[model samples]
Target: MTSIALIEAAAQRLAGPARRTPLLSSPFLDEIAGRRVLVKPECLQHTGSFKFRGGWSAVSALDPEVRARGVIAFSSGNHAQGVAAAAKGHGVPSVIIMPSDAPQLKIANTRALGAEVVLYDRANEDRDALGAKLAGERGLTLIKPFDEPQVIAGQGTTGLEIAEQAAEEGVSRADVLVCCGGGGLTSGIALALEAKAPGLRARPVEPEGFDDVARSLAAGLIQRNPRLSGSICDAIITPQPGDITFPIMQRLCGPGLAVSEEEALRAMALAFLRLKIVIEPGGAVALAAALFRPEAVEGDAVIAVASGGNVDAGMFCEALERFGG
Candidate 1:
């Protein structure tokens, strides 16, 4: 488990680089969920997601000499952008190994941020093996997206903010629904809440088919997703819960919730029409759970972390037309 002290240390390093994204609320959302809902719009974060915090934390924590050697990372999109932006900030080189089929916007943005982009076929190639090989050949540090302690601690900054911001809104106790991939964000936030606000419970929210975290929580063991490519929530869709992240989640989170693809799209559309914010499908899973899985949240107040907002224009338009106004 990532200690609160480590998370706080990461927070200190993140204050200069990461943006403290807003906690937003709307009367319409409240009515739909039938509870006072607070949203942490991490989509508005630097690099367009909460990954920036972890990226910066990992890069900045490196020894000065090691920082000069550069960093390597593997991500679908969000983490690519995060590591790219963070490496650029530190004046160090970064190499990102991403799937050839990853969202084009993310690939372009990673290049724009000055990272070398390596494309691999997700079905036939092993991203982990490729990343490690590249790191070894280039003498670069490999930054695992979710398994790293510093990365998890960096992500906990969001939980710290959620605890403080919720207090400001006269909310001391609320069910926190976090969009989860490999459980880094979920576990990080859960640990933060355990130390900062014990009254608030953290829950993992995942796409229906990729609900490995939910299953793992119920089974009391780490679980892998049966299939990784069927879901539209591409930003997530990891093969399994991370080894380091699973233990933290098991220790800190309650039973998880899973939402359908249609429900995620509906939540994305609702976020646009009601909250006036754009949220990616994977990022909207927590909001979808909060909106559609009412029984999962037992409190009067619910806080859903809208983790990212990086979608293609066509996808956004489709979500608007097919799901809501």
Candidate 2:
């Protein structure tokens, strides 16, 4: 199926559960950029991230027999909560393999949603192999975090909503800035935006250390990270883009941009103070890119997807201090 069809299917599948998050114009950012800046606050989404949209769509699309067998997933954080929460809603069992260094709050949240959590060391172990083994042993289907079509289509719903919301507000078209991890959200959003508003540009933003998507898009191939940079924006720190998402992103996304760790933290603080929204470091990268690279998006209305709000309290305080809050 096409990206539009997938988005429609995801909308239908997640109709009742997933929140239709609003796209509100940010007066503060607008003043700073001298153009209308809208914020798609998916941090307010169920499970504190947009991952629920894809997770629910994937599970709900399954045949009854498959659903009965349950599902398994591997995630560092947000995706785990999404899959777990969706599984709970569907009355299906779920097992999530997460990195041992994942945030405690995310791990707890996943378990609280009634999914079994398995921790693995990301540095030394192959999470995919472990997840597949667990899935085979338990007779469960493995739901990939970002590489699956269902997941991508589900994530595309954000773009659909952005387009609809922008039109509703009398804004014809706007540049969309989305944070990239494995390219699922960026690729999906780009497709949705292309369909919804052909003139609109979709840009993927990444942290300085995790610029695999940006680099790969420029080089016209998938590239691996030589070494993970210890950026505060951990959510978008994937080592590489997914096979399913890379080609789509190459076609749909404009030139990608990278922001520094300090800039990301400042943007996070700005979102909390000015926008009154709690955004994690990763989620704030898009806004940070806009702030640091204004010339690239100058004179165009922009929509930044603040993807999640699951930050450790200590990190939040540290971000505030770093940004002079």
Candidate 3:
């Protein structure tokens, strides 16, 4: 869990580099969901995802000498890009271990950000093991994507901004539907909402077969997904919730919501067509829950966090053409 003070400091650190993504609205979506909807397009964020916030926060927080030792991370894409970009900004080297099956666009983008990319098989290989070996051998700092306090604090900055922005738009309260993977973003935002906007509730949204967060919330214990590789929403496909993130979510978030893969694809299509934004399947889960499971949410207004837009061109086109039906 991240402290409000840490999130506040992250906000200050990121003020210059991090973008204040727009809170978007669509009349078509409002009619479909039967409520006012505000979309936070983190797809428009640097490196095309919200992970950059935590990546920057973590990398920038390092002591100058420690930063000079470089950093290593394990991510499929969004976090890889975030860490690479942040390390580059600090003139520090970064090495990312990504699944071999991860989208090529993400792989290319990570390397393009000036990080060394090491690919491992998703089904047969262990990314954490490889990352640890590299970190030990090279004496590099390991920036765990969502488990680190600095990363969570950095991610909480988004919630702080959302609360401020929503207030400016005359929205005092809303159901904040966040796409959940390991619960880093969801937990971070939940803490922020707890402090800054208690009326605005944070809820975790996941894909049907991989709703570990949802199951854990229901069972009153941490749960693990049976399989990790089946979901189209790859960005949010962690095998289990984060150790640091789960407790915060358990305390601050309401019941989690799960959407079918089809619903996620359809939500991606709708976002591209209606909001004119490119959202990855994982990133669209919150919007899917809002558009498809509106009854589960409270209040007349909902805020959906579209967490990333790092999909490949082929997948993006396929979603737009086939899922729209």
The best candidate in terms of TM-score:
1
Task: Say which prediction, candidate 2 or candidate 3, comes out ahead on lDDT.
Answer: 3
Residue 296's C-alpha lDDT in candidate 3?
93
Candidate 3: count of backbone clashes, pairs at least 3 residues apart or interchain: 0
lDDT tens per residue, model 1, 1-325: 4799999999999987889888998999999999998999999999888999899989999998988989999886899899999999999999998889877877889999999999999799988888888888878998889999999999999999999999999998888999999988998999999999998989999999889999999999888898988788988889899999998899889899999999999999999988989999999999999998887788899999999998888888899999785
Among residues 3 or more apart in sequence or in different chains, the pairs in candidate 2 whose N, CA or C atoms overlap within 3 Å are none
* Per-prediction CA RMSD (Å): 1.4, 1.7, 1.6
Error of 3 at 167 (Å): 0.6
How many clashes in each structure?
Answer: 0, 0, 0
Model 3, span 53-138: residue lDDT tens: 99999998899999998999987678989999999988999999987887777788899999999999878987778888988888
Better of 1 and 2 by TM-score: 1
Model 3: residue 171 alpha-carbon error in angstroms = 1.2
Colliding pairs, model 1: none
Q: Where's the lowest-lDDT run of ten residues in candidate 3?
A: 98-107
Cα lDDT computed for each candidate against the true fold = 0.91, 0.86, 0.91
